[model samples]
Target: MKLIFLGPPGAGKGTIASRISKDLNIPHISTGDLFRKAIKNQTELGKKVQQIIESGDLVPDALTVALVKERLNNPDVENGYILDGFPRTIKQADSLESFSKIDNVINFVISDEQVIQRLSGRRMCKNCGEGYHIENMKPQKEGICDKCGEELIIRPDDTPEAIKNRLAVYYESTAPLIDYYKEKGLLLDIDGAQEVGKVAEATSKAISK
Candidate 1:
């Protein structure tokens, strides 16, 4: 199953996709991870990506498409794969269609308030980069990392204002792909506001059919 998981930031697409990847025996390919790997390996494309990222600019569609194309050519993807964060725009989606046929696009639907609440409550360990949540996954001690005994800090991007801004950007850029895939009869909407287990169950059921 060639799957694309789509959602606003904090909608838990990554979490659900990781679970589904293991259950379905497919690799979960995130574009962010691809970029990081490329940069770490110091490939030519990686050099360009590093420069673009250092300048605080979004990578061009052509460059991103090239990266996805290279990844899809790997032998492991011959069976199937879950794409987590590529094709964020119609142009990118079009580019994807040129090289691969996506079986379905799972759209995780949640409201802006829910997104803000979920993201703003998240905390990360200063030392080990472990994650915690204020309401959902609290540590043994307040504001402390259970694993490393370090202080937990809210990422700057996890601030309420930053989350709202990210949602706005998501709506502006990636939301249209919902309709794009829906018109092709390949979009599945899942209620992401539900508990994580419930949401995962719903997603599995949706894709299984």
Candidate 2:
């Protein structure tokens, strides 16, 4: 199942993508993770990405496209893979289409208000990086990480103001992909306001059909 998971910040696309990837036995390919791994390994591509990042400039689309192409060629993607954060633009989508055809594009739908609330309430473990929300998903102990017994902190970008800005940027940059895939007859919309399990079930059914 070559799939594209698209959504704004706090839409739970990553969680849903991880679940679907596990269920289908396909690798979950996230561009951020790929960049981090490449940089950590200090490969040739990693050096170029590092230089671009250190210069505080966005990596050029050609480099990004090349990196993704190299990743997709890995053996783990032979069956398929779940794309979490690629094709953020129509141009990138065009680049991807040149190499591979996506079977389904899951567009997660959630309101801007809900996105702000969900992100603002989220906290992460400083030591182990586990995530928890102040309301929806809480840790065993107050203000502490259940896994690593470390302090939990709200990320700076998770604040209401920052989240609102993120939502605006997402709408501006990534929302167009919804229509792009819809026109291609590969878009499947799923309500992201529901409980996690319910959303997962709906997504599974939507893609199955």
User: Which residue pairs in model 1 clash with each other?
Assistant: none
lDDT of 1 by residue, 144-172 (tens): 99999999999999987888789888999
Q: Give the TM-score (vs. native) of candidate 2.
A: 0.94
The best candidate by lDDT is: 1
Give per-residue CA lDDT, model 2, range 1-209, as digits (tens): 89999999889888998899899999998889988988999989989999999999988778888899999999989889899988888889999999998999999999988888889899999899999999989998989999989999999899777887888878898899999999999999999999989989999999889
State model 2's lDDT: 0.91
* CA displacement after TM-score superposition, residue 116 of candidate 2 (Å): 0.8
lDDT, candidate 2, at 5: 93
Runs of candidate 1 with Cα error greater than 4 angstroms are none
